[model samples]
Target: MGVDDQSTLQPMDDTAWTFLDGRIDAVLTTVRAESADRAAQGQALTALITSLG
Candidate 1:
């Protein structure tokens, strides 16, 4: 998913999309780790993970 400034710039290229995927995966992994370690926060994490989907 790419957004352009001023709603006019071109979409990101394939390499940029790959980089975005890597960053997104890193964030998801971090969230999952936190969720595993904090049962009380599972609901919030679930919401975040679901929203990502």
Candidate 2:
């Protein structure tokens, strides 16, 4: 979707908004899950490093 003006707000279709909202939600969920997994792995690595040292 392209915007006509930066300052002016244009009316958008309800269905378009709904579709965009769903897509954004899916992206957010995926990002959150990946971040959680990365954090857990980092904690485990830190624990292992401390034990080795």
Candidate 3:
């Protein structure tokens, strides 16, 4: 779940993938938080895409 605006130079490693789970968890948490706070789906989705980026 890691990338830069520049070219993909340094390849991703296995260790980096391990942290991907936590990143996904955080994105879900943010989505839930937005819903709990009555935020619009658009806002939640924005957060989701931002996390993936």
Candidate 4:
């Protein structure tokens, strides 16, 4: 779905979050230097991860 398609998104349960977080870490480890857009995305994901705690 598109970024603007909020209607299709739903919040996951705590169990799902725990599962996804590990997978996300695995994917994130492969990430390297890129453009400012990726930097912005990293910042935003960091904020979301922080909010879950």
Candidate 5:
């Protein structure tokens, strides 16, 4: 799914992860969210590093 598609998804609750289909859209969605969060963290760290230089 595209990034625009992801914007329409409601944030999953903890229990929602347990009932994922065998096709695992929930797993993929969670992974994508995590990857986006990590990317944001990396950008924040990079900014800090640049500021320290």
Candidate 6:
């Protein structure tokens, strides 16, 4: 579905919002963990390069 299709959609009820919010939270948590892991890896790589120089 596209953004235009969403315009015709009805408003969600509390139950739907609750379910969507939970899913969003789970995705956000995963993204945050992955971001942190990448940052740590970058720092380690930088340290390794510095040590070699």
Compare the candidates by TM-score and give the number of the best one: 2
Between prediction 2 and prediction 4, the one with superior TM-score is 2
Predicted candidate 4 versus true structure: per-residue lDDT over 16-36, tens digit per residue: 555656656644654543533
Clash counts for the predictions, in order: 0, 0, 0, 0, 0, 0
Q: Candidates 1 and 5: which is better by TM-score?
A: 1
Off by over 4 Å in 3: 1-14, 34-53
Candidate 6: regions farther than 4 A off: 1-12, 34-53
Question: Candidate 2 — worst ten consecutive residues by lDDT sum?
Answer: 1-10
lDDT preference between candidates 1 and 2, better one: 1
The TM-score of candidate 2 is: 0.42
1-53 per-residue lDDT for model 1 (tens digits):
34555233324456555555555565566666734645435555555566556
Colliding residue pairs in candidate 4: none
Candidate 1 backbone overlaps, count: 0
lDDT by residue (4-40, candidate 2, tens digit) is 4422322455664555455555445555674566655
Global lDDT scores for all candidate models? 0.53, 0.51, 0.54, 0.54, 0.44, 0.51
- Per-residue CA lDDT of model 3 for 1-53, tens digit only, reads 33652234234554554455456565577666734644554565565566568
Instruction: Give the Cα error of residue 10 in candidate 1, in Å.
Output: 12
- Which pairs clash (backbone N, Cα, C closer than 3 Å) in model 6? none
Query: In model 4, how many backbone clashes occur?
Result: 0
Residue range with the least summed lDDT across 10 consecutive positions in model 6: 3-12
Cα RMSD for candidates in order: 9.1, 15.1, 8.0, 10.3, 15.1, 14.8
lDDT of 5 by residue, 1-53 (tens): 75434333324433432333322543345446734676555555554455435
